[model samples]
Target: MTLLASLTLASCSTILNNLPGVYSIDIQQGNMIDQSMIDQIRPNMNKRQVLYIMGSPMLTDAFHPNRWDYLYSNQPGGEPRMQKKVSLFFDGDRVIGIQGDFKPSALPVIKESEETTVDLPPRDLEKTMWEKITNLFGIDDIDRSTESDRLTEPGPATSEPTINYPDDSMPR
Candidate 1:
């Protein structure tokens, strides 16, 4: 009877070990914005009118109260995610400019469009080969070495700096 019980227990253990691991699927809802709603906005529209048309802004900068940013991002499965960002710049209470992923040319004509053009420097093709080789190997000098011994050899002078903030009232 003891032999039979031991064999049964061992069989149960083996079955349990062979069983597939527990896995859970998590599906997150997409946050892409409706482009039709954005197209309806006019240049002369007030804050209340804009809010009523486009809903609440996603991000608001405290330093620059005039700028209202709306961002919508979504990722489906392992596919590449999509992002839509709209920035409305206000001069006092009136909307001055509107910029985003949507085509500006198709937007309603404004009397005084305050659009600012940005020019980015051209990329160098010489370093492309080196960058591709490094990325393929997935090897980074920073990751391979410890924080303390990155570029410089370990010594008293190379030690981490200690921060000391002096009180304003104390005499030097």
Candidate 2:
């Protein structure tokens, strides 16, 4: 009886929405705007600057060139739905007013306080990869000119290897 019930329930679990071959679809459409984007908007900002701050408007009416609308809607898998709308009113090339579903928060003014220094030694930025490798191998202290010169200087002897082929004198 228990086994029969378990099998029935298992078969029912694969029905409708949770069917085995069904793939859950992600529905995301429109520009995603946030509060930070809204905060960037300032009065009298140029159209180009406003466009750069907020992504391209979702709706632009041909007759109303002065008005631009930004819209966003997202319904991701297993997540709650989200929507944002912002309207920018422009006079000629400049922004006149901004009205939307979001509020622009006051930006925090950073105060420059006393300057502090770490007193650490200046970095040696000129060090090459070979120099770093040599330092890692603990060969930095030694005056390794022969090794260093051999590495940097390119000549015929270093370029190609002489492969030894068996001459006639050897046992065939």
Question: Which candidate's TM-score is highest?
Answer: 2
Clashes of 2: 0
In model 1, the runs with Cα more than 4 Å from the true position are: 1-32, 104-172
RMSD of each: 31.0, 14.7
- Per-residue C-alpha lDDT of model 1 across residues 69-119, encoded as one tens digit per residue: 888876544346667888888988888888887644465643466889999
lDDT of 1: 0.72
The lDDT leader among the candidates is 2
- Quote model 1's TM-score: 0.43
| C-alpha positional error of residue 171 in candidate 1 after TM-score superposition, expressed in Å | 99
Per-residue lDDT tens digits for candidate 2, residues 1-172, read 9999999888887465555656666677777788778877877889899878887889999999899998888876535787878889999999888788998777843446698978889878887788888889888786556777887887775667866757766545
